[model samples]
Target: MKVFNEIETAKLLPMRELMEALRVAAQDCVEGKIVSPERMVVALKEGGIMLSMPATADDIAIHKLVNVNPRNSKEGLPTIHGQVVAMDALSGVMLFQVDGPTVTGRRTAAVSMLGISRLLAHQPKSVLIIGVGKQALNHVEAIAEIFPDAAIHMRGRSAHGAQMFVDQMKSVAPNLRVEEAGVDHDVVIAVTTARSPVYSELAKPGRLVIGVGAFTPEMCEIAPAIVDASTVYVDDPLGATHEAGDLIQANIDWSRVKSLASAFSEQPDFSRPIVFKTVGTGAWDLAACRVIKARL
Candidate 1:
């Protein structure tokens, strides 16, 4: 199998390309054209978790094995690492391998971008990203590439942490600033793993809020009042019911939550606030592989 390195994997899955692929995959998932089951997660001794995600579609099949080790941060190492393997669905032949963390980070960011493209009534002029982790960096890069003109702002627990994140992202989002502007950001994305709420401000019209982190029910990024004030949409309808920490903690009605496919098929009431929660699925990974495989 042809093995692609981290940089190579990134080159294969460009922001706009992967975002479009995710769009198609989202529709396919809704139509039952793709088969992606709930991921199998195993806990490790060090409070880490090993995740196995598999998906099969008419065009491609993929499996992602990723280990998330939060304790690695103390050793100055990446928190997540793994690889994604692609295969011919019919022949069952391994075709190629790509870096798992790359696919996860980029695809997760692309999901947010897709949400922005489909949910927002207009282009986001200003965006506030909460958290200084890898997900935040991926989002900054994705937004810069897809919406080059949009002003990017980042927020962290501390000012130093936020500035350091901006310094690291200078190459991608040079003008990225610490979010202290008086004007309201058009989009607010919370990518933190905070158990308590990180963004509690009430959701308002003309603003889109996206929750990227907080997978388990014990974790949350947005406050309950925000989820209550906004029309909630999740990237994976099935996954959200179980993994969407913010929504689950808020005790929102599942039937009221809409899917991303509905965002494309049905028109939303833009006059009201909107919240997009994403607890990723393997279908997105399968779509990401298709983007890279097509180039090969």
Candidate 2:
């Protein structure tokens, strides 16, 4: 069986490649070419911690298991951690094990970028990133690579954390401006698990917003105003409706929002502000793993 570490997996999964793979996966999802069970979740505390299991399969028919937790920072550990086990489609033999933490970070950002590519009007000139963690840093790297001319604005709960994120990213893209300020940008990406809203009034009309945070009903990072002001898109209707607090708390009619599958199927008008929310799915993990394996 093949085993992959974080750095090895990172090298195998680049943002542009992952985004292309996810685009194909999204089309398959819309055409009913994939089977993805609704993600299963278990709450650990009243509303503080939770565990999730999401799985998927492809032409090779190997199924992958991804275990994820969104509350581990307090213990000085990664908030998301787990392993991906690839199994034979017929005999169900374990074929390989890959680091889920690395897969999750890469795929999550790829999925968001996939949505952005399909739904947004034009490439963004600047990006506003909320929360300064692994996801945030990975997102900056991914978005910067995709949109080389765009500047990145990072914000975190602590000034030091925000500054650290800026410094680390500056090393990679020295010409890129990394600041700790709240300003409207062409794109806004939120990846925190904050229970309360983080940036409510920062969204401007005609901007693209991506919410990768708050996979549970009680957690939300983007403000309700953002939801109310933008046209909403979701990766999975059932998953986002049940887990995305930004949509749940806004009390928006679910019928008004379009799923990524349907959005690509119908080719809707995206002339106004838009919001894309994802609770993360197993199909994405499988899609990413398949792409990484092929590259290796």
Which has the greatest TM-score? 1
Report clashes for each candidate as comma-separated counts: 0, 0
State in Å the error of residue 132, model 1: 0.7
Reference-based lDDT, each prediction: 0.92, 0.75
Show the lowest summed lDDT stretch of 10 residues, model 1: 174-183
Residue lDDT tens for model 1, 120-206: 999999999999999998999999988888988889999999999998888878768888858689899998888899998878998
- Collision pairs in model 1: none
Task: Tell me the alpha-carbon RMSD of every candidate.
Answer: 1.0, 2.4
Q: Give the CA lDDT, 0 to 100, for residue 177 in model 2.
A: 51
Model 2 C-alpha lDDT versus the unseen true structure: 0.75
Tens digits of per-residue lDDT, candidate 2, 154-244, equal 7788777887878878877553455545555877888888888886765556688888887888888778888887889998776787888
Task: Point to the candidate with the largest lDDT.
Answer: 1
